[model samples]
Target: MTGKMLRGMVITLVLAGGLAACANDPSITDTIDTRSAPDGMKTVGVCYNGNNTTRAAVSEIALKACPKGTTKLKLWDKDHMANACPLTKVNRVVFLCLH
Candidate 1:
């Protein structure tokens, strides 16, 4: 392969890697549900790495978001396809934050 072509390929790979790293950041993955929340309460969602995992990781994220207090309402998979707690594979925790 030509030197210039090889360099271009390396640059493309590096840029792709950077983008992938940014996309996987947990902070960016978390979401908040304010649209459906009742007055004085907000819903916080956090993602975990493993499926069917404990609440510890997500709980920490919720607590950080709430600061005052929070109540875990439900847990679901990454897609929010099912209502399951202690999530199964790519856990996304939903918590009710009191405001």
Candidate 2:
């Protein structure tokens, strides 16, 4: 290929990669519902913009919602098709807190 064409392709690739790298940078919303389950258990709903959100970020947010005496969190359900959240959050992750 010509030098000009190669340069153009390189520039395009760089820009695309930059945009893709930012896919996981969107804000996430955590909704905690204690009444959803019985005592000693709680449900956490996470709303995210993209599917690229890191697992660590999601786990951190859920753990923060745990009660004062919570020992660990048991993942009761994780439903991607559950559109309980609005905005750009297409997936719904439900974590059940255990004390």
Using all chains and alpha carbons, the TM-scores for the candidates as numbered come to: 0.47, 0.53
Please provide, for model 2 over 1-99, each residue's C-alpha lDDT reduced to its tens digit, 9 standing for 90 to 100: 999999999999999898765544433344453235666456777655555777677777777766777677776655554555654456657677776
lDDT score of model 1? 0.53
Model 1 misses residue 14 by how many Å? 1.3
Candidate with best TM-score: 2
Each prediction's Cα RMSD? Answer: 6.7, 5.2
Indicate the worst ten consecutive residues by lDDT in candidate 1.
Answer: 81-90
Runs in model 2 with CA error above 4 Å? 1-40
